[model samples]
Target: MPRPRFWGEALRDDESGSAALEFIVGGVVLLVPIVYLIVTLGMIQSHALGVEAASRHVARAVSSAEGAEDADARAAAVLDSIVREYDLDADTLDVDVSCVGDSTACPAAGETLRVTVAASVPLPLVPPVLGLQDATRIGVESSSVQKVSRYWRDG
Candidate 1:
């Protein structure tokens, strides 16, 4: 009889639901920003990878080409392809291609090709926290350099 009374009193004193509620609130508070940050970082990283790929594409084209004019066109085409493939707006990307250490009016050997791609990546869900109406913009810049191939010397 005494044990039963003690068990009933313990059950009445227990506050199990309180812990569940606290856990729920805490989980929500901690999980939301963590998820947002992860998504934002993923988006930024994806943009960075795209920029790097574009830079490498242009640099390789320039290194293998006989002149800057053709290389420039190839670079533009590569960039456009990347933008379309990644579903990124063309206006958001800024691409620049140039030859390094070229003193002549035309593309030359012993020179390096440089390509830089910059873009603004949108954050996933941070705008509401900052009281802004638009998504947060993150800037990504990638550059690549390629040494002129020896075969270009004959051209």
Candidate 2:
């Protein structure tokens, strides 16, 4: 007959499966934060890329347009398309258009058209309560400068 073990004897017995249990528990504790970090980084990087693309395309469209009205239309179109494609929040998006010349008018002939795009990306799992999401948001910005063609005209 097998001998019945006392509580002390049971405690002294070789621990089976303890390593697996510890590994599972430890892995879960470490893995959750690691995964969250990766997801948050991905979101920030996507927003950065989106802002960059928006600036570049907007500058290009403005510089290439034939007139001020055309330039406005082109910039708006490009910004809208990039915002949609990158899943960026238009409400938080800010765009600045300027000219690197003595004249304040943008996209002038022989001038540099500068387009700056900025946006905020909310962190993953951030709660909207108490404006925590807004407080925890990461800001991303990008600027692009394109030279306007010397032949550029306002028709």
Candidate 3:
């Protein structure tokens, strides 16, 4: 013989599939932010790598160039190509080149050339409205140094 439950008692005790439902709801609530965090970190990391590569390559190009003009051209070309390849926002890109030597002029022969590339990476899915895009940006910068040839020439 089985005992029959009243409607109120049955409803109160009825938790058969509730675990799965609660699990689903709890998972969704926990997962959304985790996914967003992963996406944000991924974007920042990619931009950081891009900036680092840009600085390293630019320094190498400038150091290996034949002359001042050649160095400028090479640096510009490398920076531009990296920007495009990395999908970095050109408007946010800034490059600084300096020489570590007594010479006032940059890219002096036998000097170490330093190149810095910096950019602001916006968080993924940030809206453009109300300046949120600009407000939520993360700044990434990288610098690289390369020594010019001691016999390097200036034209």
Best by lDDT: 2
The candidate with the higher lDDT, 1 or 2, is 2
lDDT by residue (tens digit), candidate 3, 68-106: 888888988998899888889989999998987777867
Positional deviation of residue 104's Cα in model 3 after best superposition, in angstroms = 1.3
Candidate 1: the clashing residue pairs are none
Task: Give the alpha carbon lDDT tens digit for every residue of 1-155 in model 1.
Answer: 55456777888888776888899999999999899889878878888888888888878887787665666677778878888776665778887766777456335677776778888887664456654524557788899988766556433
List the pairs of residues colliding in candidate 2: none
Supply every candidate's count of residue pairs whose N, Cα or C atoms clash at under 3 angstroms: 0, 0, 0
lDDT of 3: 0.90
Tally clashing residue pairs in candidate 2: 0
What TM-scores do the predictions have?
Answer: 0.74, 0.88, 0.88
Runs off by more than 4 Å, candidate 1: 1-13, 126-135, 149-155
C-alpha root-mean-square deviation, each candidate: 4.6, 3.4, 2.6
Regions more than 4 Å wrong, model 3: 1-12
Model 2 misplaced stretches (Cα beyond 4 Å): 1-13
